[model samples]
Target: MQSCSPFDQAQRGDVEAKFQIFLTLLAVLAGTALLARRVNIAPAILLLIAGITLAFIPGMPAIELPPDLILLLVLPPLIYSASVAMSWREFCANLRPIGLLAIGCVIFTACAVAVATHYLIGLSWPVGFLLGAIVAPPDVVAPLAIARRLGLPRRIVVVLEGEGLANDATALILYRFAVAAIMTGAFSLTKASGTFVAILAGEIAFGIAVGWLSLRARHWVRDPQIEITLSLLTPYIAYWIPEHHGGSGVIATVACGLYISWNGPLLISAATRLQGIFFWDLVIYLIEGMLFLLIGFELRAILERSQGIAFEDIAVATLLVAAIVVVARFAWVYPATYLPRLLSRRIRTRETAPSWQAVFVVGFTGVRGAVSLATALALPFALPDGSPFPDRDLILFVAFGVILITLVGLGLTLPALVTTLGVARDGRSELVFEHENEIAARREALAAALTSLDALTDHRELSNQVVALLRARHDIRSQQLPASLDDDAYAATANARALVRELIAAERKFIHAQLRAGKINDEARRRIERDLDLEEASLTNRESGTAPL
Candidate 1:
């Protein structure tokens, strides 16, 4: 029987189904986002859990959001959004460790799981490797998103994101090779290496072409809604264009994502940038939320497939594979992060390359979710010699086991690890972020005070009222600032803040110069950006407000 689903209904051109599921998911996302500040866990993970609970309800047919559709339609926006938010320098600094963990660690993890499955779960070597390939890539969205929101160190966040970005290609490369070997009954290291290289090169080439071409298309269009719609379709174009020619869709999508934003300053207008930012961010959130939810939703499907497998064997194998993944991260991360610094002869580096706590945090967060489970589930539903795919049911079982062990175990454990590691120590980072907000408050008060002083020249009637309001604000900030800061720290902080204010004023001077020279205009987005620039200036700058002479 055909599965009944919102997507299926939508396909039949049911307008209600088209919007209903999307609107409901969006509303849920909105509610979760509102509560995100109060809650420590990521809203994506929360959504996944909720989706799983919903899936267990009686008479709710499974919604099969096709894996390729998610890959082609969804992943690009999320990757692009993350890329735009990334600072190039921070991402570059962590590039080495990110490569080691994403590529080398993914390989290690796949092998670990494959071995465990072959020996412990009684699967053949190639079949076990196929399972390994599935669960190998670590899902960082759940952790990295939470870490970024909590304002963890930029370096840590960059490393996690960088790992997340690159590991897709790594795991996909492995998946492709393992699946091919099973399908063709032929496997060779030399051939696998060749295929990997081709996939990488082809993906990069395809992305560069699509990303640049998309920008060109945007130049001819002025409508924000149309541009945004075009932007939404871009990832799929990038993915499918390459895949049709037998290239890696995952790498192509990621490359296209990075290319678009990496060239944003040069290629994108301020209006386009603003709309693109908002558009892609919303799309990414929806896709990321749905992707994670699907991971949990498919848990039932996995259990159904693995029903004949002995629970005792599956449990033991999962534990062993889990241990391997955890230990392998520590094995790789500690050594890899330090090796770079140790190798640097002249430049002194931080002694703590990656704190044991950070290493442990990354290690424990080995949660295998969407990519792993999807690749596993998508494992060719056929076998070599035209027979049914060999042991797909068992392979799916082990893949699910890997995911369940990693996610349920690590997701629950990561919070305690955070508390223990003191990464978010005393909740001080939140206070720091909030302080800038407070400073903005003080600036408004200063503006009102100055405005009041001016109103006296025009009319004394309104002047006194404005003065009274400004006076109240001054008194509040005056009392609050001291309690919130130590004398030396406040003064030093103020001096640092003053430097930033001067720097921004200096930057503004150049920007205005460019405007006068006809290089740019003070457009709507520039006004918004100006506010952000000043807010950033105040966050780091210590200068008191004063009227220009």
Candidate 2:
């Protein structure tokens, strides 16, 4: 073999180093996630801390997170996943509130930041507005994860999730306008407003078109693997088209996901849904964990770059901006929640106003995350004239500070706030109500299926034995459903599920023994193992209250 050239050797060394770094990061992510679960803290918090620790360790390489890596690669799937998971009916029903928060609140908060920074920090208006837009939206992934576990009211969850889905579009649009104004030293409210409207309309139309085409294609393919591949591609298709043409891409992805969510159930096959759920779940989990870690790692680089700025000044700007973000949300949320009903009689008749406690919870959950930092980092180092961008380092430092404070401070205290306000009690009651409705729906569906089965039996020639077996199976399924969601009934159901799980374990043990003894081939064993695996998974889901009724 010939000796490798020096350049080739260097290339090989670089690749090896990168691969090692990848493995090390993966190890950190896994450990942090497990520790978070054990300590009953949000994983995002721990992941961020872990990343900070790793970043400062001697001899550890500095990892640069490209702005596009987050904007182009990570964001689409996260937004799409959330949009798909959201209930379309609930989303539409709460559209007014969602829009207020997603659109109006973002605008208000951005403007608040702009004014505060201009007067207090002495940044120019355009640069201040740009910073405002960067930090306007609360992170969807972090707060929703915590809120769902706390069992807040379903409507609150829906509104928060819905707001999170669309707020990025609002913030990003404003960000672009602010950037443009700064670069050209001019601004136009009228033209910008018209452009904003046109982008929204165009993206929505494009997103729906993408969703429709994707659904039809998946249905035609009829193969689970191919359908899953298409599902993975759907969001990118929806996002990239709009983004490439000066739109936010967020609205288009959200619209696409919602369209597919409402329409997909009837078109998608059971196998595809089943496999796709697991695939997407794992994908989102890894992506989210890694994103937070990378965010934490960015701190070291930011600190290194901030050598020229006074620590005291950076701290003051960060604290002031963070305070403004929190206070402005409360000021905006209360009015936004109640002002419409106050202004319109028709609104009063159509909607019941939420409690003050719930509104407070919404206001208190303004945790920021990766988007603000990414946007700030994406800011140009120099203006179009090759002059240094004013206050660029300060902007980056303050943005990071705001993210750290909100994510750690507000996120940690939210659960206690909800508890003190007795929101969890309302959430529990809502859960009970939902469980009752689910039971009723299940019974109605079974009855309908049985009625159809009877009609088919009357119209076609069928053996009595076959008809009897089918009837017995349906009866067994109906019997398995709990009569009510009472303590005694729930306990009985849990005990039964535990017994079924034990039986499944025993079956697996026997199957493995037979395989070891050469009683069955690998292929046969795998076939049987797959069936058993699915059955066990169903039981696990049912036990955890995640199974579909």
Candidate 3:
């Protein structure tokens, strides 16, 4: 049985009142976010801003952010949704780089900031480490949204996403260890390492098992609404299963997401896909919308508590930390990538490897919002000795400081960084379709030649030979088109071929430029782009001889 969250205290005897409160909160924040959006602001951004603005309103509700609010209520589903939506192939291809950035650089940032904050800021190393741990991992949603809007390079997206996906596990690991140190007044390197490994293994195992169980449950009861509800619960199951056993909730959620969606093609039938996509889409949209609003709503607490320190001190520190994070990212990114390639004498390959400028752009893209603030707010109010948590307010102040600097600072400069970095000098995406077009054209030619001979039925043996060859052509074309298309439809279809050809040409220019500029290696680029080429090509041929445009 899943354990109820500590926050579920409200969900018990006062369940109806708590439920009403919860629904009202969601409605108000969601509604305000929507209202703000009508004025051309993003709803999520509006949600946060509006929520914060409302905090000052007289008698406005100020919800205390219990630890369970973040760890249990918000995190599980968000993490699971990301995992469920993750493209496994992208994850695999970008694994090495992701590991380097997420783990190595995360650890690096934590250590760097720990030293800087401890000695310079005059805090205990453990407290400093906690602060560093919170700031090191870029908020996943922030970077993902920025990357998407900037129309950044696909390779860059992989790095950002790769780092984001894996770093959650790393940051959470460090956070756990740091929390342990604070709680027990002792830290163990060997024990930490052993614990990390155990948590990793446990999460992977637990998540996979739960996902498989969920998949079976879905198979047994294949209702779309139910499956989505199951999908919704998967994250919680993945999280609580391991947490119940003192395992990594982040890893468990990720593992469960991957497995549930692993056999997406095979497991989710056509009927399920239609229902599942809509169901999950709505669920994710609602979650994302509400979460950002919660961020602002949560911020009101931080603002109300900022009495001891002047805005100037907070501003200066925020600026300082923000600068350090950007510098630290570049300091960590370029060497982390290129140094390995230099050692192996094996040029690192990708659709777009991180250039120096790209590193700078990515570094600045670190907008610390949800996770950092939440971590700070969630910090226990008192230590085991019942002493006020050391540097607690300072940490909270700096957390907000970092968010302000990154969001306002980098957020404003992001557009300029895009052009300066030349990351997208060619275009946003690097999908190549020319090869798909060629294959399509060839298939069309072969089919046309066969059709020409089809009228010669008097020659049975020749006709049989042509038919055999045409069957082979058909098979080849099937491999080239998108998974959604059936061979008969693709080949017999008229518009498919022409549309595929145009898309392929656009892609060819994009891919070839990146290839020539050393953005992507030949082999990796080709492999990364192989299916797109095939799909586009086959689809093109199917439409090749359609009546003249």
Candidate 4:
């Protein structure tokens, strides 16, 4: 009987089984997405349900996500992506509300949950506080999912996004302090507050530095492939550097992401920008799907870990804690939403009073997600004295309960809430506004190009054929810009552009066939491919009413 290490066995594990699981999971996610689309429901909620179902299948392997991996690998990129995509202008416009929700509401919720857990459940104070920290921050993804689908108000979306991006950092900081207090049996409010301030300041500085340096490097490395690679790596580096030095990596990653996004036009090529968007969209899709599935799989382990605790007690505790989590958000959100406006004449003059319905929706949308689960699971298994961590399993159970209740309960009802509140959907108006802006810019650019063409041709020798071709294209484009942005005019332009795109696609297919048949050399194929790519990109830009830069 030779001894084989678990690491060795894992390395030599059933490759086929792993491959089957990957393929099956992808299929499941694809199917779930289709169902979500068909039903007009949030895909994430569906994915979560599917994942839970999958966990109960006989002979399924136990899937465990290491806490550090979630914090370091998963959290950073997801946070960075959301932060980068955020409109800094909008974020600033809603800064007061965002700050109230992200910082003030998170602490308020934590304290409320802590009190409920300690008094109602009879958990130790530190453990109760630990549980509070775990569930304090609402997951940004779920609310944003519904917001995107429902075309919710921009202000609501911005506030939710800002809270999502910043709250995790706050909650996690408090979580670390709480965990330490539990482990060491020591506590310090002044010291923790000071450290919190230091972490926020330090991480912001580090993120700005990393972003500046990375952007400079990206400029130096002009290759699109390398630039995109650096873009993918940037989030991780931004996050890790801060965490390594006792700073809030969430803030650091967000700062770096925002900086790069703000300067993206100057730093990145248009092709890279297009490529990066597609890449990140796919990455986010896969990660979100896998995350929900993992959450579902954890159910079995979470249940099993609570062997000593009575099932009835667990049920009661889970319900009470979840209720507290929901009520606490409402407790904070209404005051946070309106109190500033009432007290400050400056605020009152600057901002409108949000409707109570909108405030209620915002409050109800606070769904616990992966961060809470990751933090709960990341709890130490045992104390330094070799005793088991107090109520660790119970904490995990409660956290998962909150996630399920909020994501399923709140997410499923949000559509009706929006309808009842009569929140005006402005997504279409925003698109029209952007389209009009693009047209105006294009009209000006064409005028300048024609002017420059006349001046240059006057000074230098030129062929009539070349001049006529350039002039003809610009003239046709100028004509395409309708005098009025009407449906009929837009449709006419779209139909014309569709023909151009079809021709480009036909040319690409023919070229691809030529390369496949070995009629073209790699160099020749590449040259043609580059031309085809530019043509396609331009066509896409035109159809989307974007600048063809």
TM-score of each: 0.72, 0.98, 0.73, 0.89
Per-residue error for 416 in candidate 4, Å, reads 2.0
- Model 2 scores worst on lDDT over the 10 consecutive residues at 540-549
Q: Rate the local accuracy (lDDT) of all candidates.
A: 0.69, 0.91, 0.71, 0.85
Give the least accurate 10-residue stretch of model 1, judged by summed lDDT: 540-549
Each model's RMSD to truth, in Å? 11.5, 1.3, 13.0, 3.7
1 or 4, greater by lDDT:
4
Model 1 TM-score, all chains together:
0.72
Cα lDDT of model 2 by residue, 1-549, tens digit: 999999999999999999998899899989988998887788898888888899999999999889998889989999999999988889999999999999999999999999999999899999999999999999988888888888899999999999999999999899999999999999999999999999999999999999999999999999999999999999999998899989999999999999999999999999999999999999999999999999999999999999999998899989999999999999999999999999999999998898999999999989999888888989998999999988889999888899899999988888888889999899888888888888888888889989998999999998999889988988988998888777888788878878888998899899999999999999988998899889888887764653233
Stretches of candidate 1 off by over 4 Å are 1-38, 220-222, 343-352, 425-549
Candidate 2 runs further than 4 Å off: 546-549
In model 3, what lDDT does residue 110 have? 82
lDDT of 4: 0.85
> Residue-wise lDDT of candidate 1 within 1-549, one digit each (tens)?
978798876677656665676676677667766565467666656766766776677865566657676555555566656655665566666667777888888898788777866776677888778777777788867777656555555567677887887787788778878888888778999878888888888887888888888877776686777777777777778777776776657677766766776665776666776666656666676777777666667767766667887888667766776777767666777777667677885424444465677666666667776777677667777665678887777666666666666666677667777777887653455445456566667767766866767666476556566667866866665544433444465676566556766877777777778888888877943984668575674463333221110
Candidate 1 vs candidate 4: which has greater TM-score? 4
Model 3: residues with Cα > 4 Å off, grouped in runs: 1-44, 309-313, 347-354, 427-429, 432-549
Error of 1 at 288 (Å): 1.8
Native-to-model Cα distance after best TM-score fit, residue 169 in candidate 1, in Å = 0.9
Q: What TM-score does structure 2 among the candidates reach? A: 0.98
Residue 32's lDDT within candidate 3 is 71
